[model samples]
Target: MLQTESEINMFNASLKGKLENLSLSSFRDLTILNLSNNALHGTIPSHIGSLTKLGILDLSMNQFFGALPLLLGNLKKLTTIYIYEIGIAGTIPQVIGYLKNLLDLVLSNNFLTSSISLTIGNLTKLTSLYIHKNNISSSIPQEMELGNLKNLIDLHVSSNLLTGSIPPTIGNLTKLTSLYIHRNSISGSIPQEMGHLTNLIDLAMSYNLLSGSIPSTLGNLTKLTTLHMGENKVSSFILQELVSSNLQTSLIPPTIGNLTKLTSLYIHRNNISGSIPHEMGHLKNLT
Candidate 1:
């Protein structure tokens, strides 16, 4: 009966053992395979690629290790892939770009290394991408054309060795609600284009090599609630009034008062100094 089955779900089943003996290759018509939250351990089976009709694959919370099999690129119909926290190591394969139908791709909390693949631009349909909490290194290349993923809503690449300024093209992702690039080695001033993220609610860029004043444009994110910019080389203040003043006093910009919905604010370990702005009181929800 496995030959005719289209989906196999063993999520959180407490199943233990490698998939080598599961005979999954017999399921020719399978379209979905979920083996998450199990004790499955071993390199992902190479023959799993034979399931050409598969659309969604989840192996998260397993004990799988080693590089992703290149044959995964053959699963052209795949739309979602979740392999979070499975001890996978090695660079993300460029073959991932072959999955053009992908919408959500989560590969967080692994030992993956090397620069992000530039071929990711090919996944134009992607909406949410999580590759955080890994050892991925190198500057995010503008050539990566992150802007090409116009449908993106959540982008997380934090806690890595990433350097270089955030590509200005990120402003093109106007639909973004959460953007996290904190805990990396990124340098340069925050791009002014960030102001275009009017829909943003959570923005974190702390613990990096970022310098320069906070962009007044950030004040435009009226929906923002949590904003963290601590532990950086930011040398100036946000309020234009303070910026224009010849005095070195760095006051919290009154424009921050505009984000009335804000509840969490982290600005510690910067060069900011001066009297706290009374406008901060407008953030009645701040904690």
Candidate 2:
């Protein structure tokens, strides 16, 4: 029961409307509810799940639509569930696997279509899972029960419509460090067990329909600093924009110049070719 910051910035009106139900439900020992950047519309009131000592629920940037409320997963002392983008359409309510002390689940840009619910491997104390730009199409099921969410660390779903591949139990999230799935429609080839994610640092998959030949074991992700694999069907290219997407194949793994903390290297349109590897000039923190 603590409301300050100007009474939660007067329910932070970004302006839309709705959420009327709880006129603050007599603050039943309210734990912490932040009405994030609001344009709040309606729905969400499954009697606010009787706010059973709620831990932290942020109805993020709102224009809030429907679904999402399985009485807010029966509020089993939820541990931070952030509903981002507001326009939340439907699905995702596998009663949120009963919230088991959830760690930080951000539903990212919503309009949720459905399918991601494998009861999300029962959130083994999840560590940060963002649903990425939504419209969720499905796929990413679990090549090993989603590596049992071993204290996952930031797994952004990336732009939606997700198709498949990438779930080699996500190399069991060896304490993952930022792995954005990239614009969707995901295809195959990329699971060289993700080089066992040596504490990755931002590995965006890039536009979809992925093909093959690039994983020189991701140069073992030497704490990479942002590597967006670029458009797709990767193999061999020299697109000055488009020469019939000229295809052929291979090269570029000069052990990715041992990723000297790269500062963003978006591989360019795909197909890839030879010799630019002077150990990528030892990266000197490549911009």
User: Which residue runs of candidate 1 sit more than 4 Å off their true CA positions?
Assistant: 1-4, 240-249, 268-274
Give the best candidate by TM-score.
1
Alpha-carbon RMSD, candidate 1: 3.5
Which candidate number maximizes lDDT? Answer: 1
The residue-by-residue lDDT of candidate 1 on 1-287, one tens digit each, is 12238988888888888877689888878898998999999898888889899999999999988988888898999999999999999999998988999999999999999988888989999999999999999787574468888889999999999998888998988999999998999999878988999999888887888877667787789998877776676665555212221222356767867888888765543456777888888889977
Candidate 2 lDDT tens digits, 26-130: 666677788888677877787778878878888888777878878777788888888888887887988887688999999988889877888778888989999
> How large is the C-alpha RMSD of every model relative to the true structure?
3.5, 15.6
Model 2: weakest 10-residue lDDT segment is 237-246
- How far is 127's C-alpha from truth in model 2 (Å)? 3.3
- Scored against the true structure, residue 112 in model 2 reaches a CA lDDT of 90
lDDT of each: 0.83, 0.74
Tell me the deviation in Å of residue 15 in model 1.
1.5
Q: How accurate is candidate 2 locally (lDDT)?
A: 0.74
